[model samples]
Target chain A: MLVDRLNSTARRVPTWIVYAGLSLPAPWLFWQGLTGGLGVEPIKALEHEYGLLALQLLIAGLCVTPLRRFAGVNLLRFRRGLGLMAFFYLCCHLLVWLVLDVQILAQVWADILKRPYITVGMAGFLLLVPLALTSTDRAIRRMGMRWRQLHWLVYPAVLLGGLHFVMLRKGWQLEPLVYLGLVAILLLLRLAPRRKRVAAHA
Target chain B: GTALVGLAGAGEAQEALEPNGWDEITSYCNYYEFGTNKDDPSRYAGQLTTDPWSVTIDGLVERPGEYSFADIIAKMTIEERIYRFRCVEAWSMVVPWNGFELADLLDLAGVTSDARYVAFETAYRPEEMPGLRFPVIDWPYVEGLRLDEALHPLTIMATGIHGRPIPNQNGAPLRLVVPWKYGFKSIKSVVRITLTDKEPPTAWNKANPREYGFYSNVNPTVDHPRWSQASERRIGAGLFARREPTLMFNGYEAEVASLYEGMDLRANF
Candidate 1:
């Protein structure tokens, strides 16, 4: 009954509201970084915050299908917005690393090539590029079934994102490992078979 | 060459040096005994009991015994030393440390002729330190330096910062300050100083040898495997502040470069 109620309420809410609400944190975080609210090392803190938000958004995107399949919650309309927002945050994370953290242009390229964690993170960001480009309604209708196949790239993209966080930490830190573990569990949930609908004749 | 000349006039260089604010020095720390976060030590280190402390000076020392913190302070002549503190994470700070040369303490203990290395151990109190609950890099953090490096005039055992007793978060009672090496090499809340022949295993090096070498001298050329050591961000520098190029031996090349003379720094690194 709660799931049904949630679904009914969800239909009345404009999907743009979710986009507007989620986008609020980005500017607020930037303002915090500017105002010294991010502490002495604001750049590092800002970079970390953006990366964390991006990972969280990716994990949230992974939850949509399972929620619809099991809980009977129809959040399909907001899935695109979630995916796009995750991409947006991922861009912010990458930009912060590039423009603010490692300012040297050659060094940035060197890092992406040399560092395994950066390589994995860059690969994850690259995977989302096509998916984001094709997120439009026209592109979705035009491509049809192929669109669904293309969007499945999110699975590996999110896994790599989680892996990046794990590798970036100094030692076997709990927080990053927990994020990676949560991503593993959510991904495993996707593998479970969907329940067969009962036949009307039967 | 210019930097070397600047450092040659050590007294004048020190006068020109501006130590970081007390807030920055005390708050931003990597005392993993307390916690890993920069502010974790400040938040959780209050639980630590630092008074009435004693250090055990053992392994090839004539006066090898538990020396009370007060006795050590009374025996030695305390002086202020302004040094550049460089972390392996590529951040740096200028700290004005109040302590005597480590050689003075070693002299008090009377180092044996065969002692090749000086290994230091941090205080291991699980009841006081929450971070110790997790097996983060094998608890009871240990670090070591060659006997000569330990005896170096630049090497000091700091008791206070900014002309006041050190805050618990910043290794309250006693801590090593090796200006030339990475900050982690300077062990914190030191309880034991053992002079040994064999090279003692260090905490970070033991954690990841590929990334953290035993001789983690602040050399910009020898980058950490995970990240570049080419440039460092000053801790209190503003958000838009440009990263300054990291100097050889963290701008203490003139003072410490000869210690590693013939040895290959890149290989050791």
Candidate 2:
């Protein structure tokens, strides 16, 4: 019954409202960074917050298919918005690290090349660029089956994002490991056998 | 060298020092005994019991016994030394510490001729330290220094900061402050000091040997595996403040460079 109620509510809520709601934290976090609300090292805190938000959005986007199949709560319309927002947050995360944290242009390249975690994070960001570019309804209709195939890149991109977080920490910390575990479970849910639809003619 | 003399004199010169704010120094800490978060120490360190503290002095020393904090303080002359505090994570602060030189304490203990190293250990009360429950590091947090380094004039055992008694989060009763080395080398809330012949295990080195080395001197040229050591962010330096270029031996090269003479710093680091 709760699932039914959630489905009904989801239908009435415009997808644009979801975009508007999720985007509110972006400006708020920027304000926090400027006003010392993020403590003494606001740049580092802001970078972490943005990266974490991107990962969370990616995980939420992953859940759409599973929720629809298992609980019949269709959120197909919101999937593109969720994905695009995740990419937007990911760009914010990268920009913070580039422009604010590591200001030196040469050092940034050095980190991307030498640091394994940075390399993995950069790869994930690169993977999402094409997805973000092809997210429009017109582009989806133009490509059709190819667009579906292209969007599957999100699975590996999100996996790398989780791994990047796990490696970023000093040691085997529980928080990053928990994020990686959640991503793995969501990806696994896709492997379950699909229910066969009954044919009326047959 | 003349530069060495000038720098040594500068330590005692009555120059107006710009130390970080008390709140910044007290709140932003890396005392992992409380928790991993920067504010964790400020939040949870209140539970630590610091009064009536005693330090166990043992190993190749003439005076090897449990010395009360009050007795140690009474025997030593306290002074203020403003020094640059640099963390291995590429952040730094200027701290005005109140304490006597560690060399004076070593002199009181009378280190034996064969003693080559000095080892220190932090208080390990599991009931008081919640962070100890997780094996973030090998517990009882240990650190060590060469006998010469331990006796360096710049190395001090700090009891207070900014003319007041240190907060529980900032190693209340006693802590080591080796200005030239990384901040982790300055073990906090020390309870044991041992004079030994061999190099003792340090917490960060044991946690990840590749990243942390025994010497851990603040060298700009040598980079940590994950990050650069060339520049450091100054805490409380505002959101848009540019990072300052880190100095070799944290600008104490005049006094400390001789300690590592004829040795390769990059290899040692």
Candidate 3:
């Protein structure tokens, strides 16, 4: 019966399950850092690790559709889990700042206002808040076509987020630019000729 | 007064340590390196060396002696003075600093007539302080104060906060705490104090003079090149809460506003 269950959907890409499996390490690592089970300065490393993971997950979430379309695989399943992981990491990033770093709302707000990168980063996070809030199947179904429209905000959010990292640097560097390029490509995908035709048809 | 630490029995000796209005003052920080993210310092600050820290007071001062953070702390009385800390970037945090006034230390050092300004420098360790690896700003972080600015009644060479010892992340042992100026003006983890006649160049000013000036007083009217400084979100308050108006000198106007009366604050800023 198990083999039959596996065989029935064997050809289908279990992308969501794969993404969920991939996200397991991120939270486990973050939890370890939060609980002081890790090495010296666990909270410190956790902050960076989670933030980087969040960005990487966002990048991977974007890549899922492209990879699936290009590689001829049914990978829509993975997109949800990977995208949710991005949301999860973003939450952890916020938590590290809220709980361990600033620990105060006023200071956090002040920091968001005082620093440009912080402001942009926070704006990016703010944009994600609504998207994450409505990411569920129920909400997506309820919202209908608006859901896809709203999800488009992620394009700018990720772009701004990449810009936030670059601005934080004292001088222009290559790493942040690479992230920016990924965001650009992700956005460029939206501008594909097929996207235009699809929108026209809709 | 190291003995003041032992004076635990004394209660309500001073004003209650009021929060300056940050939504989360407990986590508000001034560590410039570690990427300027509010939580970045929590990760990178552990690498900083706070023990056996000393400041060499030289230049125009007659008593140019190296004072260990221990000697500096024990000698002065600890007071819980909540200060409004405004960063040059435009955010503000009201911190309950624990240390005596800078006047106490200045009097001990005995500044000479030639002393026009006091310059502060942080330890230059590129290896441990990870932010130093990239020249985010000029190395050996610097800050300066006019003689009057240094002697402001509220200025304190802060050693602690929230009625307890300062955590290493928040400039432990010794740091210049100037509530009236931007947060960076309150140089942290101080290593050198030089009294010089020439106006000293600060870290930010050296990195980008237009953005940072020597007399970086907390000003709401003057906008930083990148952003506005008209208001601030008080840390420790709930998220999305109403904000308060930033004061001329962090609401210490009664004591410090007069000091900058004649000077062109716009130019100075």
The lDDT leader among the candidates is: 2
- Give the 10-residue window scoring lowest on summed lDDT in candidate 1 chain B: B1-10
* Candidate 1, position A17, lDDT: 88
Residue B14 alpha-carbon offset, candidate 2, angstroms: 8.5
Candidate 3 runs further than 4 Å off: A1-58, A61-161, A168-178, A181-202, B1-17, B20-26, B33-35, B89-91
Of 2 and 3, the candidate ahead on TM-score is: 2
lDDT of each residue in B60-173, candidate 2, tens digit only: 999999999999999999999898899988999989899998989888889999999999999999999988887777888999999999988888999999999989999979
The clash tally of candidate 2 reads 0
Candidate 2 lDDT, tens digit per residue, A1-202? 9888988899998999769988998899999989999898888888999999999999999999999998898888898888988898998999988998889999999999988899999999999999999988899999999999999999999999999998887756667889999999999999876556434334
Tens digit of lDDT per residue, candidate 1, span B35-58?
A: 778889999999999998999999
List of chain B TM-scores, one per candidate: 0.96, 0.96, 0.88
Model 3 agreement with the true structure over B54-126: per-residue lDDT tens digits: 8888888768899877787778888777666776644566577778878788777889998899899987777
Highest DockQ against the true fold, candidate? 1
Runs of candidate 2 with Cα error greater than 4 angstroms are A195-202, B1-17
Model 2 Cα shift for residue A86 (angstroms): 1.7
> What local lDDT does model 3 show for residue A15?
50
Q: Per-residue CA lDDT of candidate 1, range A105-193, in tens?
A: 99999999999999999999999999999999899899999998998899899999999998988887778889999999999998886
CAPRI category for model 2: medium
Query: The CA-based lDDT of model 2 is what?
Result: 0.90
Question: Which lDDT values do the candidates have, in the order given?
Answer: 0.89, 0.90, 0.72
